[model samples]
Target: MSFDSFLSQIKSKASELKTDVLKFKNKDFLNAAMAGSALIAMADGSVSAEEKQKMLKFIEGNEALSVFSTSDVIKAFSDFIGQLEFDKDIGEAKAYQALGKMKNNVEAARLLIRMIIAIAAADGSFDVTEKKVAQKIAQELGLNPADFEL
Candidate 1:
């Protein structure tokens, strides 16, 4: 192959890889958001509309987050929530498991910790339930819960 042709092929391959990376990153956030919602829902028996709004707003406003459609996010949360609503074990463990998945990615791990803290503080008051769940999550994420001070 000629030099220019080789360079063009390399560039095209790089672009393809970048697009794949972006897609993976987006899917990760979708899963992470599902986990976050699970955590919020389990902190109490029911997930309130106001609470859902707060979480969605936070995700949308995050500088690093992608612009996911409301329906997409709702679907992930709904599926998890639906499972948890009737199934006993799903809700309680979902967020914790998700947090574990992101542990190797330091940035994602830190963000997840911050999110749990934010969710714990969402209702204008942090209670024992939120504190306990958040603490467990912090531990699972290998973060210092005291640093987050939930």
Candidate 2:
């Protein structure tokens, strides 16, 4: 009940609130990024270990997405993968729905496209199927595929 103790409690609560606010603000971006990663990872008809590693690295390194913990990113990516595994068509629809959320934010959309491209090429080869998927993602974001040289 001391004044110092009360001040400490308020500070702790404020810090927690800030963290929550940050997570909320970035949730959409995280989902979209993971969605795109899943799409591209599956473009080759399989999700390779290399692709997943690249995605984790990219998200961890990126300033905007670095706020998220590894577990959060992994969960988001796994959710997309699970959807894709259960049903291809439905999974794609949902992934596109997530990407569509960023359609209006050109900067975020561009970053997402870049992230997916990096993931696709992570296995040392960017195949035709992967490029096609990336193109679709770019279009979903209301961006020009050629802009990213897709």
Once fitted onto the true fold, the runs of candidate 1 whose alpha carbons sit more than 4 angstroms away are 1-24, 48-66
Candidate lDDT scores, in order, read: 0.64, 0.80
Please give the lDDT score at residue 48 for candidate 2: 66
lDDT for 17 (candidate 2): 39
lDDT of 1 by residue, 40-106 (tens): 6567776677866666675454433334665676677666666667764865576557667876776
Q: What is the C-alpha lDDT profile of model 2 across 95-130, one tens digit per residue?
A: 999999999988778777876786677668898898
Q: Which 10-residue window in model 2 sums to the lowest lDDT?
A: 16-25
RMSD of 1: 11.6
> Number of clashes in model 1?
0
Q: Kindly report which residue stretches of model 2 are placed more than 4 angstroms away from their true locations once superposed.
A: 1-25, 48-65
RMSD of each: 11.6, 11.4
